[model samples]
Target: GVTRSHSRPKVSNDNPYSEAHFKTTKYMSDYPERFDSLAHAREWFDAFISYYNHEHRHSGIGLHTPASV
Candidate 1:
């Protein structure tokens, strides 16, 4: 197998930040179990985006919302 020097060490975790975000999104109380239609899915996503940007405080950016940042 070809190896790259830029690859992360095997001992280190891969993309922990993204993993955490996925977990948070999946675990939110408002996260729907399923969407009824395309429009409904869009509506749900819009609401989630609003909450994530305006309401959720991201610790990665000094505990500030993405909108504030």
Candidate 2:
């Protein structure tokens, strides 16, 4: 079964966790100003997802990587 968010329309703060992740991605030093192509974007996101799950530590999760949790 899947649950749906009941947040109001046009509410950007409806999901704090996702907002936080977006902030982290935007503020990354290596983040590109613009991806060259769809393939390039995919490659970058694949690497980013790997690092986010395997290397990035979250304080809310007791500083453990998502993969370790």
Candidate 3:
């Protein structure tokens, strides 16, 4: 329901929420500070999304993967 609203810097002092979510989901406690400079973060984010969509089941989605549902 709540999507990007403030494109202007004045309107939104905080960063865009979707971008923020991506950064949070991609970067976590276990990941290295520097992941091969660039490839590492991208690779990990890809893997994480794959696992989240396919391998990781959620009860909220009737216990089915988001892709499957």
Task: Report RMSD (Å) for each prediction in the order shown.
Answer: 7.8, 9.1, 8.3
As a whole number from 0 to 100, the lDDT of residue 67 in candidate 3 is: 92
- Number of backbone collisions per candidate: 0, 0, 0
Ranking by TM-score: 2, 1, 3
Q: Is candidate 1 or candidate 3 better by TM-score?
A: 1
Candidate whose lDDT is highest: 2
lDDT of 2 by residue, 35-64 (tens): 999999999889998999999998999999
By lDDT, the better pick of 1 and 2 is 2
- Where is model 1 more than 4 Å wrong at Cα? 1-17
Can you give the TM-score per candidate against the true fold? 0.68, 0.79, 0.51
The TM-score measured for candidate 2 stands at 0.79
For model 1, name the residue pairs that clash.
Answer: none
List, residue by residue over 1-69, the lDDT tens digit for candidate 1.
Answer: 977685454546688766677778889897889988999989987888899899999888999999998
lDDT of candidate 3 over 1-69, digit per residue (tens): 879864455455566766655565656566576678578878887887787788767676789987998
- Give candidate 2 regions above 4 Å deviation: 1-13
